[model samples]
Target: MSTIIEQNQSNIITDNGLFPSNEVMLDLKNLKKVYPTPKGDYVVLEDLNLQIRKEEFVTIIGHSGCGKTTMLSMIAGLNPISGGRISVLGKQIKGPGPDRGVIFQAPSLMPWMTALQNVLLGVNQVFPHATKAQRNDIAKYYLQKVGLEDAFNKRASDLSQGMQQRVGIARAFAIKPKVLLLDEPFGMLDSLTRGELQDILIEIWNKEKITAVMITHDVDEAIFLADRVVMMTSGPKAKIGDILDIEFERPRTRKSVLEHDDYYKYRKHLIDFLEH
Candidate 1:
């Protein structure tokens, strides 16, 4: 049976929620992804493994079609692994669960639902045992946390793409998931709005201390948000090229990220890998 261990080794709980092990939050071992096509079989990811410590923010960068999203999906349990092993919070991922929440390339809000309702759905589903009033309070708390209070009752269609993404972010975070799997969370936003949300996201992460894994093609974004950045090579079987430690001062501002001496050094390394 899988064991669940907190980072400190003091709060170990089992998979059944009793005996948590002291394992890292995420552990991927010799992970691989392959596909069977009529032409034969094509490998998309080759022996890709990653580990994430609790409360650490990690960003993944790669070329288009480089299996970055595929890797994220595997970690989120949205798709099955073709080979190897993955465990989150001491348990092997069997499928999607409340422990893992995903914000995809798009906001993916239900057009028919209001912003409040969209955010409400996740909490309600995950915390069914809680009282109606308890869930309501939790849902609204997260909605306002993302600055969507003014549009709380408005339909999702009424919100701009960036605003819709706020709801998605609120919803994913509302459950207090141990893992936040962000696949280009701000990819669709305008540059100004994207920058705004980046600050907000960092603030929330600091407060919540959630373990976050983000997939982005933007090197700057990776440097700004990640404690570590993992770069992947081009596909036909993409694999990790290099792992970088951001090593910036805590509570990093955008200016700090841009001004840091090693900022461009790491950025260039990622750019060289992607540009080549």
Candidate 2:
């Protein structure tokens, strides 16, 4: 991983050597978000700007309450922005739509629904124009893709936490969203389960070719999954403190990414700001 300082170096390994702001897909310009608090205005973001290109996995690493999740909520149109603008494919995003899919920290599945039915909810809502057969096929395909084939008939309440998250991933993918937003999707799982799910998510991302932005506190997970690791500063109002380019080859394995020359350097860099 290449840190903020390393980005200044001309020879940094970028995709076809493209610069940061040149090939943009989703762009945020001078975004500022403030929340109403008893203590007055609590600003989360100030003059924050970012540009994400097509089909890139961008992972954001920050301390708690650094406003990383706030930024994602704004981008997903789940929350209103206090100022500035966010554009998706050059169009203003004013509200939540099927084009942006979010996998939040918790599974948030309906207790009364089965795993298969929960996934079908997204299919029903997003692909309302399609036939019943098509919706069923899509939902089934996504569930199987996430390794939940056997659990398809199980109720959400009956599944384990890991199993529930798998269902959540399948459901999010069922919509065929243009962008995928993940908020600590693997944080709740055990080490072995976490690795397995990470692999599953990587496979899904490769097959779908969807643009993904994830907010994670896990340094290892950020480096393992993302094309670039974006670090935020400590906040009342946070800005981009660092941007790290991951130089590991495609289809990155845990051992390979860890063995890379700059891996420890990157880890050390991120550890510094974790104090906040």
TM-score of each: 0.90, 0.89
**Candidate with the greatest TM-score versus the true structure:** 1
CA lDDT of each prediction against the hidden true structure: 0.86, 0.86
1-276 in candidate 1: lDDT tens per residue?
122223344655434342234446887768899899999999999887677877889999988899999999999999899998889876789988879999988999999999989988899999989999999899898888888888989999999998999899899999999999999999988899999889888887888989999999778999999999998888978888889988897788999889888988988888887787
10 residues in a row with least lDDT, candidate 1: 1-10
TM-score for model 2?
0.89
Give Cα distance to truth, residue 113, candidate 1, Å.
Answer: 0.7
Off by over 4 Å in 2: 1-22
